[model samples]
Target chain A: DAGITQSPRHKVTETGTPVTLRCHQTENHRYMYWYRQDPGHGLRLIHYSYGVKDTDKGEVSDGYSVSRSKTEDFLLTLESATSSQTSVYFCAISDPAGGQETQYFGPGTRLLVL
Target chain B: EDQVTQSPEALRLQEGESSSLNCSYTVSGLRGLFWYRQDPGKGPEFLFTLYSAGEEKEKERLKATLTKKESFLHITAPKPEDSATYLCAVQATGNNRLAFGKGNQVVVIP
Candidate 1:
């Protein structure tokens, strides 16, 4: 109940189309992360931000990009969508000062590209 | 490389039955371990955090114990609503990154 919301709960797009998903947090946490989950394979980190204007790629950073201009908003964009990118995307936030080292997740956004 | 492996891909238990789920992890320098529960079509919910070996934590009917190599989540007298996927993740020292295991799927039948 830390006030995290993900926009466009579900989306369907065509291959090669550009798509963007939004994640908003009201708690103003310093750390934010983007992850994708698929069947049989567990969740994998896509990108993370340590502070405003500071972002780093994860293991599966190919074909995806993220930006955090404000502390409350983190955006994930797929430059050119691919069928392989179809999965459930999640956004999480954490505060290391308030014992917030543990990440809390959003409701999730399900995406399908055909 | 940090790797995590969970055993018993899927488990089915009847109401009032008790069982345990296993999470085995291999990290270069262990910093922290976490447990999460997730339902179908939803994001994961945090359950516990273990920092050192021989550490144990409990909540309601769930108890988590961590050792040097693996961790176990024990459920006692499970109910029908206890069915969900349990996930394990480990954070390495000096890095703000976490490596997660695939997870253990548990189903409690009424």
Candidate 2:
């Protein structure tokens, strides 16, 4: 409950389409992260933003991209959604500079690509 | 890549039963270890963060301990409400990213 919120609690989209998930935070933390959770694979990072306009790839960033235009918002986009992309996406925020390396998460967004 | 492995996959306990969950990790260098609890269809809730070997943290009926290569979460006399998936994660020396374990699903039958 660290003032983090993810949009689109659930969605069903067709394959080969574009999808965007939004993560908004009120804490104004310096770092924000995006992750996808699967049944057997736990949670894997997709992308993260350290500051506004600064982003980096994570462990599973093959087909994903992210952008942070403002301090409070981070967006993850899939240019062409695939069935394998159907999973629950979680947005996390952390403050590493403030000596708090722990990341708090949002409620999450569940996406299904058919 | 930092790797984390959790054992048993799942657990079942009667109310008032005490138990422990294991999390083993391999990283180039350890920065921090974290423990979280997740109810089904919900996000993970932070529980504890252990900074070094021999470090320990506790809350309510739960305690988390860390060693060189692994961590343990002990539940003391758990109740039905204590049932949830416990997740473990590690942050390596050079990065702030966390590598998470598959999590241990716990069921406490009342």
Candidate 3:
């Protein structure tokens, strides 16, 4: 649980529509990451934020963008989602500054694009 | 790129049966290996973290051991409550991203 929560636990949208997912944490961790989990693909990173206003692209960052306006809030936006983007999205927080890479994930958001 | 492979996508065992799940990984330089349990429609829950080879960690009915190239999660006398998908992930040195295996689904029947 890690004091993390994701908004819009489930959503259905048409292709080419825009969608935004929110992740809020109370731990005040330094790192926040957005990942998508699909069958046969485990979890793939989409984007991450190390600090407020500081973000980076990850392995599968193509169609996804993230913004961390505050320490406890990270937002993921898909300008135009496609069917391929339909998957279970997860938000994980970690403070690797302590030398541990273990990430704590949120409940998750299930998205379906038609 | 780091690669993680978990064997036997699905496993079923009777209550009180003991078994082990395998997670093999290939990475340029391993920093840490992590184990997580996921239940239906829920996010992954962190279980243990092994920093280096020969490192071992344990919880109530689960024990995790790590090697240079792989890791094993041994379940001792499993129960129906233990049924869930076990995930293994590896974080390479100097990297903040985790490379994870698809997962191993375990079912314990009473």
Candidate 4:
């Protein structure tokens, strides 16, 4: 409902392979975040971008990297896939200018590593 | 470090029954607390944002209330559609990241 979409809704890759997921938004939001959801860990932030070319690491940033070259697109890449990296990845957007911290999420992407 | 803990990992309620979910947290400086509902195989949907103590927000049958150290989500006359996992998260002052709880799973039988 937020005009956000994640490409490759599902993916299966072998270990040691590189995988990249894409998140695209049409709301022109200033804040974009990438998170992973596991059985007992809830949703953990992997990385986030405040603006074009501005990024920061989150609680679970290991084995993952993110880049935002434009306002509407954010990308998350796994340099080398691992079995432990298999989880559901989500993308979210927020507008901080209006003092709104509430984040709207996309559908999500499920990744499997074997 | 900010931490959020949710009690009663799972719950079951009959249609038309009322219940509540608890979310307790500890943060350096409270900026806001958020409640989200997540369906199976889907991303979380934002429900409410509570800024400070003594604040309450409502949408339909769901009501969220916040205090100094915790928050509660009360459901009145719940329906089978309310069955889902409820997640709670906290954002601290001067921090843009959120700390999340494991979430509480609710199953409302019709």
Q: How many pairs collide in each candidate, listed in order?
A: 0, 0, 0, 0
Worst 10-residue lDDT window, candidate 3 chain A: A94-103
- Please report how far candidate 2 places residue A8 from its true position, in Å: 0.6
lDDT of 2 by residue, A17-84 (tens): 99999999999899999999999997999999999999999989999999999999999999999999
- In candidate 2, the residue pairs with backbone N, CA or C atoms under 3 Å apart (3 or more residues apart, or in different chains) clash, namely none
**Highest DockQ against the true fold, candidate:** 3
lDDT of 2: 0.95
Give the CAPRI class of candidate 2. Answer: high
- Candidate 2 wrongly placed segments (more than 4 Å): none
- DockQ for every model comes to 0.85, 0.87, 0.89, 0.87
Give per-residue lDDT, candidate 3, residue A76.
Answer: 99
lDDT of 4 by residue, B13-87 (tens): 999999999999999999999999999998999999999999999999999999999999999999999999999
Tens-digit lDDT track for model 3 on A1-114? 599999999999999999999999999899999999999888999999989999999999999988898999999999999999999999999998965467999999999999
> What tens digits encode model 2's per-residue C-alpha lDDT throughout B1-110?
79999987999999999999999999999999999899988899999999899999999999999999999999999999999999999999979899999999999999
What is the DockQ (computed on Cα atoms) for candidate 3?
A: 0.89
The DockQ value obtained for model 2 is 0.87
Q: Is candidate 2 or candidate 3 better by DockQ?
A: 3
Q: Per-residue lDDT for A8-33 in model 4, tens only?
A: 99999999999999999999999999
Model 3 lDDT tens row, B1-110: 89999987999999999999999999999989999999999999999999888999999999999999999999999999999999999999998889999999999999
Judged by lDDT relative to the true structure, which candidate is superior, 2 or 4? 4
Chain B of candidate 1 vs. true chain B, TM: 0.98
For residues A1-114, what per-residue lDDT tens digits would candidate 1 score against the true structure? 768999999999999999999999999899999999988887899999989999999999999999999999999999999999999999999887667888999999999999
